[model samples]
Target: MLELDASAHPGGIALWGAVLAVYDTSSMPPEIGIHVHARSTREGDKQVDDTFDTVVVKLSPDEQATITGDTAINFYLSRFLNRDIKLLRCPHCDEAHLDAGYFAVRPHRRHMCQACGRQFNDSEKSISNPVSLLKRVHYDVPPVRAPRNLDVKQTSYPGGMQIWASNPALVWTSARAEEAGLHIHLYDSQGNIVVDDTFDHVEVDGIELNEVHVQYFMAQQALPHLSEKIVSLTCPRCDRPHFDTGDSAFFPHVEHTCEHCNEKFVSKGRRKLVVSNPFEAVRKSLRANWQSHRI
Candidate 1:
């Protein structure tokens, strides 16, 4: 059999080679090591990873090494099966069994095979090869987001469903609650918090809410209200927004202390109005129509 280090081979389908030698597993080999496997699969590249579904295997190198060209000789065979095999054919079934040795029973052959259920042969023959993986060693494996969603707030809790970790907990919580119902939170692209009543209890006792699109024709129904106010006082030093709504919306020189930066600054009494409650007022409103099709 041919053996090479080159990556492109017809035998590339094999992640594990066939067993070469079967030794008494009374001990283990020392050179064997493991690799923890994980992959990031989606960010434009993989935007996400699955840590929970990871496997425990001999760790493949994080960076794959480039393999090219071929080695000169067959350093190994398939299953790394080289010239060092020690097996004999069972006369009755033509099956291969580990040859014990010539000296064990010099005058006669005495062997029993479990595989083919062949009776022991009382004839004389030669016995030869032996296999051992006794020094088998395995090293220990040393172990080692998101939000484009609009600021959908839990305006009413106990009213909305909190996802339970298990089926029993979900059933129990559904039964003994002060408030139990279906709840939906809508977040639009370009940052808008949707506030609408339809996002509330559809079944009043439902555990599932149909995910509604934040865009399209039916989006008008799921769209949040666009009439809400946002008040803020930001520090020029720290860029921390403050919520101090004591004076009117038109105070000229509002004294402010930034909790983040611990610096003080003065600015106008600020009360900016953001279109909330399923806000869809966009400069690209026509684009949402002309660029995309009706749903």
Candidate 2:
């Protein structure tokens, strides 16, 4: 088997490396089954959708492995969410980090210390968010593209709205980014041109227009559209992140409080996301609708 470089992302790699190093896989179970469960968070949903995949690795019965099936399952599950490597410490009873909250980024949403046997609770530990984790692992790595300085401004037109597309525009630059992938509506001030930017090209939405949204629109050519954005903010009280749903009553009003820190934030109103990539916006809309109704 080809070996993966262990030095990369030292913390996370080290843990997996240690597992691989300690596992004597020469003798192990031959038939291994993997069952992945898609958990639904809808109300009144108590069922899990299970998808199974099997791997047949030839091994001896006496072969010793550092990790077992259940442990391996947990290990793989950790990969779904990006974790910080630096926060992990000694898993041994001795020399282990004794904390109830996050020990490292690699193992996130931890409830207990595997090494020291401590129960994690709100008062004791600090939890990381998914966006932060993503930025840490992939965004912060060295020798990568530098962060762009984008000047984004939004304003209203007569009957629609206009959001200035920021630079490093993936839509224009990435060839792989299909036009259909665009989820956005461009309208002229007269509320005349309601262009639905679709995958291959833009289509007119009710409002008559000569063309879809051009790369540039005159200030006079914009429309007035309501904007509802979801923002995640850390609570001032407990410093835990909560999604701000804005203020709208027609949609579900969720009160987001940090389960650990008891920090409180309210996510009110309906979530309205306007995507310049029509495909993404439509897809997200479909998903949202499905989730809302399915639940």
Candidate 3:
């Protein structure tokens, strides 16, 4: 018998990763099973949908020799079918798979089937229902930990705000800001005050000020400060170190593309600053920003 566990981003058809465990019903031991961890991505050809790029196969050393060609093929076929790795066929014609690029455009609300020329909306209902070849195996993991030290500061200019952190682990929340005794405000490019309110929470992308969406815009403006303190990690694919900073740093489940090879990988663990004097670091950062403003 085969048991499959899978997970994906919300509204995303692509499966981020999946675990497939094969067990003999008669000899089912909680600890013993053929385990495979497959990580899926759409890195290379953007036109192509998700594909399994990395796979970690785990089996007992004793059972390793028992795996034959037929068994291997069956195992892999089951794994693929369980994870929904197949392309999505057009419901209208069932001839060609829908192009992700065309469907991704916001204005193209309804996707026209290339073969049938029938336009259909990829509605929430359609998205929720995927063609599954095998019974879904329910498996879930704890949510990723929120980044630490997501500090927000009211900017020198009225209605202007900035979010900063020493590392990429910082996740900003309205509650965290409030705890830090900070107030939320919106400002324009010209430093004109836009909105000043006492709101309980602020959705990064939901707030609009002066006809402009402020979702992560303010956080982006303040990212450079944190970038200076970013630590580098060696890319598993390229074997070259890449800086863990910029937009990729803050978001979860987002992969960082290597600058050299363009190989994309997610930062799994947290990297922290070993500051003997954190106060000095803060003062220096502030001083540097102050000097830059004058210049």
| lDDT of residue 168 for candidate 2 | 18
Angstrom error at residue 120, model 2: 7.2
What lDDT tens digits, residue by residue, belong to model 2 across residues 1-295? 2122222212221111011111111122222223211112322222322212322221123321232233323332222223232223333443323221112212334445565676444332343222121111122222322222222111322233222221111001111211212233344555464543332222222221211222211111111231233233345677543432212211223455554577655543355232121122332433353345334
User: 1 or 3, which is superior by TM-score?
Assistant: 3
| Off by more than 4 A, model 2 | 5-92, 95-111, 120-281, 285-295
How well is each residue in 36-132 modelled by candidate 3, as lDDT tens digits?
3222232222121222323222222321122222222223322322322233457877753333211211123345666677776654322111212
lDDT for model 1: 0.25
Q: Residue 138: error of model 2 in Å? A: 12
Sort by lDDT, best first: 3, 2, 1
Best by lDDT: 3
**What are the C-alpha RMSDs, in order, of all predicted structures?**
30.3, 19.6, 22.7
The C-alpha lDDT values of all candidates are 0.25, 0.27, 0.31
Tens digits of lDDT, candidate 1, 1-295: 2222212221111111111111111122211111111223211221211121112222133312211111000111101222333335577886544432122212236666535877566345533222211111112311111112222322222122121100001001011111222223322342233432222223212122222211111111111231123223456776654433222211223455555777866554343332111112221232243234323
Candidate 3 regions exceeding 4 Å error are 1-88, 91-93, 96-111, 114-116, 120-139, 150-295
Instruction: Name model 1 segments beyond 4 Å from true.
Output: 1-175, 178-229, 244-253, 269-295
Distance from true position, residue 107, model 2, in Å?
12
Candidate 2: C-alpha lDDT:
0.27
